[model samples]
Target: MRAADIDKLVSVGRPTIAPDGAFAVFAASRPDLTANRAVGQLWRVDLPDGTPRRLTRGVSDTAPRLAPDGAAVAFLRADAKGKAQVFVVAAGGGEPVQATDARAGVGSFAWSPDGARLAYTARTPEQGRYGTVEGLEPIAEAPRRITGIRWHANGLGYLADRPAHVFLIDVPSVDAEPFYEPAPAVRPEGEDAPKKQLVAAEAVQLTSGAGSYGGVAFTADGSEILAAVDEIETDRRDLSSRVVALSADGGTEREVLARTALLSVDEIVVASDGTVALQASGVGEGRVDFIAPAVGLYLLEADGPRLLTDPDVLDLGEVGSHITAVGDDFLVQSRSRGTVSLVRVSRDGATASVFDGDVEVAGHAAAGERIVVAYATPDSFGELALVDRGALTDFGAPLRAQGLVLPGEREITGRDGYPIHGWVAVPAGEGPFPVILQIHGGPYASYGIHLFDETQVLVDAGYAVVYCNPRGSAGYGRAHGRSIRQAMGTVDFHDVIDFLEGVVAGDERLDGARVGVMGGSYGGYLTAWTIAHDHRFAGAIVERGFLDPVSFQGTSDIGSFFGDEYVGVDPVQMAAQSPMAVVDRVRTPTLVLHSELDYRCPLEQATRYYAALKRQGTEAEMLVFPGEDHELTRAGQPRHRVQRFDAVLQWWARHLPVTG
Candidate 1:
């Protein structure tokens, strides 16, 4: 797939299964290439038949939640001013009614069990002075000095420095009288000050502090609320959160359920029986895990907290699983070995797979006896399917690659004698094709059996692309991930070379003489280091890679912390491991790509490496992106993202010949 082709595909997000399980709701955004725009709308899919239908018109809608009665659907919609407000539409489809007119935006909401009120968190400006106002004086007979100094402020100038608060909205009844009445104007003591009456509405501020509330959930009985709280402290990222139970009426009295040390909670789902399941993660690892270990599922029983499911029997590899609670069952959307599955876990520990395949499962819901699931894979954009508790039929077929073929996948033994896995994608109807060895970032991340467009594009362009999970990659275990803590370019880079040699021996389509290398971030750093240490590769593309650890330590945002974890030494050893320090050995053509706003591995790393390459008389070019951060490859500007891929493709084409 070409970059332009992949960019045309619609992006699906925030799939939600309806309460009755007869339908599912999800958001889809299609890119308008000509207008350089994106249109996001809500969609619904019927259960058992997997038929999709558009629910909302041209509006940016997200976070769809079905009411308990299944008569209405509540979702967050962005207005013309880009402010998110809550709106409710009939489950059968109709004009959405605005529920809340919050200016700062509303998210992380929960509908009360009785469906009489809705609770959500919204950003509010703190009333205080951010800094001293200069050249300010009261227009009076005598000048006066400003009295008080407040720590924070609200309004336009001080908006970004404000905090967030939780609020409750009451559902207006059809027969009841209006709850709000406009307040009358008030006059000052001597000189009358203009004052307007405010509406007589009932809204309670749940928590007051410099903290943020996220992942809010209501208890089964709707008597209490559970939320994850992160307060601003010395270390901004070091969040200490506990499941706090607040009164449904917004009372100040609250109690903490579970206290965590380093892990930050992400989402929470409360069952009808009062069991709460959450997705959380600690520092360093991005994988979200189910908090209470040894308890596959927990139940808040009369006696105490009890384990509902057996830990050993259930597969816990689904770290970032999404869970939905029904009457006595829990619908889990989990991924294991790159395959996503929708499973129903009963109160008695019995589990049944409603749907399972190579595709990625997004949302799942169970209403009464019916179940609905939303899934997406590399080949297909988005799919909505329905499955019964006991049904065995497959609603949607697994996605398969067309017109493109992958070379045989194999495992090669690393220099340390450990088996390393890799895949070789060979161009269709070709021989002796130029090879591009692609390395994935995240020394702790793995390149699994997942769909990727860039690799496929290389194969489509008559080049064999090789990808591997070198040492320090995850999924194998903790020890393998810890191997590259201080050995950066040594073991990990050699593992790639060994994997490439294995691919050359097994696949006849790959050309050993015309090999190119490419990677981003950690992979980018390795690409730069690879060409420096060896001349096997004919060309290389280093995208946002760190060239010198010593320079990165001072230039990057988290440099001080990362340098200690990865290098385990001071600036001296870091300089020794840097590719820029050994640039004289580089002989292959190289392209250095970086973003100006990348604070992780700042652009200076690339600039220094490019200068060294030029001073050494080595073939090198630098591609710097303006107004882009470290996420340029994934979530950067659309135009520059396309340019990034084009630059890499062109660079490789110029140095490595594509054979037919």
Candidate 2:
């Protein structure tokens, strides 16, 4: 597909089903090239063999949740000029009435058991700060007291000053206008004609003081709320989190439900029997645990946390995986072998696969025996599918008919006879095509069996793409993920090389001599390291690479412990593991791409690598994207994403032309 097809790309978000399993509501979004942003709306479909219909017409609406009684659906809606606010509409369809007027807007919300109230999270900016006062410009605001490690985030800057807190607001009537504002009292000329005073309902702040609280949900009885709390400490440099049960009445006391040493409490769900299920991962307090710990599903039992899934085998939180309590068991998204499928985990830890196939289930929602999933296969980007009687009924078709190409799977023996799995996608042609060795970031994230725009674009431009999940990637169990720990450029590097060589050698349609290597983030780091050590590629592109571990420990959002945890504290060893230390060895023409506002592997990484390469007389260039963070290639502005794709094709054309 061409880069401009980005505007036509469609994706589905997390879905919610009605209590009676009659219908489901989900948000689907597509890029708006005219506005240079994504626009989303909510859609609903009846159970079993029904067609989907648009429910809400907001510019950007997401996080749809059906009320307890199934009479209404509540979601977060944001206009073009305003922050997201809570809006509720009828389940059938109608106008959505705004239920919140939070100054900073809502982050997430959950419906109470009674369906009369909604518990949500919103940042409480300090007075006289963040435009809390009228006519106050950001330049004139008071200086921030920098004391916390999480003072600034990538997309949302300066987070420590305004911690997100839980709030409770009642849903407004269907016909109510200006729901958050009180109507002015009117009277006749004399003393008292007929007085009418309609006071606005105020949302009650549940939790207070420091720390950011979210992922909120109400207990079965609606008497209490469970939320994951991240107390950003000034002394410690970790994201260790805890779960607490707060009284729904805005009580000051919070009962600590669960806490771990190094694991982050990613998601929390309360069962009907008062049991709380948690999704957590980590081995110890050390930073190495953050490198590749499996996300496990656990039950916060009275005795202790009981792990339902094996930590080494099953990752419940991979690739947008989610958990939904069903009966006494939980239906969780489990990732393995580059595919995410639904797995049923019982209370006693007995596991059974609900839906296992050659597809990646991004997210799913279940009600009773009904399950709906937003999934992707090799030929389609994403589509909403319903699971019934062990069969999947897809609801939609792919956007483009011609440009999509299915990847051919390949396996090769690596170091010590270990198997490395990979895939190759080639354009429709007779002659051998120039190859692009594409590497996925996360070092811990796998290249799933899905239609990736990056690979498709390269194939459409007359270049074959080779991508693999080598060592240090997820979906292959914990050992494979942590194989490259403290030894970043060793086994993982060889595995990638082995996969590329094996694929090209076996395929007659691939031109190994005209190869161009490119990757982002950790992939960028490996790309830089590969070109520096082995000059086989004609050109290389490193985007948002972690080149220097020394400065990364100070500048990146997760840098405080990431570099030290991955490479170790030893100065000499860190230098040896860093790509910047061996940058002078690179002889390939390189193109460095980075985001100006990226907090993860900040812009300095690209700049340092490019400057060092230029100083050594190696051909190199750098491109920086403004107003975007590390997620530029995935979720950046629409125009910028197209521009990036254009730049990549141009780079390959100049260095490793398909015709040449």
Candidate 3:
């Protein structure tokens, strides 16, 4: 099997099971290399039969949720412009109704338990000054004339004066009388007729202060609501969240729960017994736990908060393991050996795997006793499978291998004696093929054993693709993951080069002399630094990366705070770690990619890098996306996303031509 062929077998997304447990909804996109630009769409899987059907026809429809009565499914639908709006469609599949009309966009939403009202958070335009404030006073002068609207920073958009507020929409009654009656009068062309005013829907503001609500959930009795807040303080980024009970009529609010430090509540599910089950994470070690009765799963209700299951529950051996809740149960995906399993925790503290095999389950959903799992094997892209309590056999038949061959995977030792795991996809029917070294972003994030589209594309185009998780990558212990701080271009780059050499040594099909490198964000920073420090790479692509830490610290939205964790000391360490400080050594053909609205890294990062390369007489080009932000890869402009992929392919083909 070739890596490109594996695209047909692997699927990645979280599915939502209906309240009745009769059906499940999920998002899937073709992973074919030739169809690399295909957008994701919502698909429905019927229980018992396990037959999957496509529901909405669009570029990408995500975050599917079944209504309380199971009459409709509400999801976020993105159009060609990449603007996502709240849409609802019949549970049985029919015309979709557009619910939101905001220009900024709608992300996470919730349908009230009563089904009469819908509460959602809307993104609004923001305008603010861009500079540092040393003391209590504003250091930069406020813009005299604001030419462009800033959205909510934090990788979303520029910040606006108005914050995202929760808006309540009353479901239009099927037989209620019209709210407005028009005046019946025809006047002459130049004469003005009597004006009639229409009744405007009133929007009730939930939380007032400066913070923005991240997620919302309705109580089982439909009397109160819960939300996560990320507040903006004077000096630091404080994320103090609480689960408050608000009057159904939108009047007063009483705090039922509160936390001191940073907390992320991913999902909340109310059990049949009125007990609230939530998946939450606190500051410090970032351990995910199931919070209930203010205690862990195994402990008695009277016994304070206990750790039901620690990090060792998944038995990932050396690789790290994390669990994500899917309805009543949780789905655990292991990154070490790459296997996914359905685990159920009983009130008695017993844990069992419902279904386990060689296939790596990417996502799962549960509805009472029925469960739906999405999985992909080494030879397959992705396929949907079903499981039930009493069933002894897996519901779906084994899917045929998609004819894609995956490359061999291996672990190499880095300069620090740490195990650096990587995968190498060799071209089919090839000898001495050009190579591409791909690095993942989120210096903290790791590339899992799951299937990827770009890897397949490079292999199909007759190039050996090598992707690795170097030092500072997750799945390792906290100390290993935090070692890259203040050493950006130093240790991290050395580990990547070590992994690349190890891959080429084992695979004779790879051409070491004709290799290229590319990455985004942190990965982009490394790509820029690699070419700047060494001329080994024939070509390079840097996407939405930080060129100069000093300038990035001032321009980025979280500039002040991110410096402490990423660069340690302060802006001084930032300048020393920045690739721009030594750009005169770059000699490779480089392509700089960035988005205009990117507040995470800012467009200036790309501009400075491109300018530096040109001044040094190096082959460099810049591609700026018009209305895109930091999420250009997963949630970028649709047309430009396709263009970006095409540009990468063309650039690689031009620099390193494929040989027979």
Candidate 4:
């Protein structure tokens, strides 16, 4: 498959299974090439056989959560401007009803235990947040004031003055009989979305506080709502979260428990027996990388909160919200090494892997005696399947015929005898094919389990793809992951080279002389570091990556704290770790790609690296994408994502051609 062919793949998330295991629902997203946009919609899958069907085709309908009784499903649909609002529809089939209409729209929601209400989050609309034209248009056109230290985020851009608060939406107990099931929500030619008559929903402001809140849930008896609320009167970026309980009637507000700065509740949910379940974590003394915070299941009862599961491989997957409670034991999603496992955690602190596979699970929902999950293997983007007992069913059948290149696993030891995990994929009949070492973005993220789009595209281009979880990468344990702090390029770089050299030497199908290294974010950091430190790479590609930690402290969002924690508190120490510090030694041909709108790395990082390379007479090319963010690959414009991969393919084909 080619890079553009990535559009053909569909990914599923936010899964929900029916009570009786008859059917399941999930949100499926795919690139709409005709519309030049990525669209999401609700989809249903019949259990046992895993027959899939699409439902509710809104512009961006996502986060499908089924009601407790399985009578209805509620989801959030984004408008043309991408402001989200809640919507609900009957499980049987009917016109989806708009359920909530807050001024700032809705964030995330939880269904009340009795199904009488939904406790959701909504931002209080402020003057500057919206305008007559549309969301933040007036502010973007004329902006002079800069009050907040952290102003812009990558995907969301400028932060609104309003803070998000908890809100409650009444779930109608009656069923809706629509006069007509309308066609898919579509925008007319040269216009916004087609006008529609939607049902008005009653909403009430649940928590009026100056703090940000998320990971909400409703109690079993429907008396209170639980959420991770940070009411600290400080910068929203630095606030530590705590679980808070708010009355369903929006009357009482109480902190459920208090945690030290060392640890806090990442997610909170109430089981059927009124026991509170949460994933408590403390990555370090104070680390900012929330992607793979060292976490374990914790339960709160009359005695107070304590760890229910050991913090070994209990690092929760990316989805922090969906903490499924199956009876007293909670079905937890944990990642060990590079593999994501659906683990069942008991109150007695015992944990067992529900399913065994060399694959990653995106989400799982329990129904009757069965479990439905959205999983992705090394060759499939996503598959919705009925995991009967502990076996994977026919979810990958539809996508399997599309021809995917699956990788084989390999392991290598890094410093201190740390075993670094990696995967290698080679095309058919490979004779020392050109290699592209794929480095995942998050220094804490893994790349081996998922059907990595870039790996597939590169392998199809006749290049052997190599990816690994270096020292800094997660899925191992706490000590191993935190080992990257203050030692960014040194330790992780050794792990990368060790794995690459071992893998290349062991296999005759890998061309070590014609190998290229490419990565983004932290991976990008390592790629640039590798090029400067070692001169063997044929080419390098670094996107939305760090180059200098000195100026990055002032320019980038979360820069000050991140540099302080990750690199060092001193300016000289921070600069010593950046790739710009050793730019004078870089001889490898490098491609520096950064997004103009990427506030995370900031475009100046690209400018610094590119200018240094050019001044030093190094072969380098720079590409800056307009209106894109640090998430230029996965969440950026579909066309741009394709173009970015095309650039990599062309660069590799020119520099390290696979000769016939």
Ranking by TM-score: 2, 4, 1, 3
Weakest 10 consecutive residues, lDDT, candidate 2?
Answer: 389-398
Best by TM-score: 2
Give a tens-digit lDDT track for model 4, residues 1-660: 777776667787858888777788888887765666788778876767655676786877888988888889999987545678888888866668777766667888988877778888887755554653466575375554655556555665555455678888778533654434457766678866544544446677777655677878887788888888754333434434577788887548887776454456667878778888877776444434443465777787766767777666577745433467887788888887677778888889888788648767878888545877777776667767666543233444544566777788899776568787889999989487988887876777767577777888887889998889887777788677778788788888888888898898889998888888999988888888889899888889988887788888778876746766678877677767889888899999999999998888999999889999999899999988888988788778888888888888888888888782
For all predicted structures, in order, the TM-scores are: 0.79, 0.95, 0.78, 0.91
Model 2 score (lDDT):
0.83
Q: If both were scored by lDDT, which would come out higher, candidate 2 or candidate 3? A: 2
TM-score of 4: 0.91
Number of clashing pairs per prediction, in order: 3, 0, 23, 0
Where does model 2 exceed 4 Å of error? Answer: 177-200, 258-262, 283-288, 389-398
Query: How close to the true structure is residue 271 of candidate 2, measured as C-alpha lDDT?
Result: 84
How much is 48 displaced in model 1, in angstroms?
1.4
Off by over 4 Å in 1: 125-160, 171-204, 235-240, 251-262, 282-321, 326-337, 340-354, 387-408, 448-450, 546-563, 572-585, 615-617
Ranking of all candidate structures by their lDDT, best first: 2, 4, 1, 3
lDDT of 3 by residue, 334-447 (tens): 333334555665544456776666556666667666777766655555666677432212212222333344667788887778678778888777489998999888776666
Give the higher-lDDT candidate: 3 or 4: 4
**Model 1, global lDDT:** 0.67
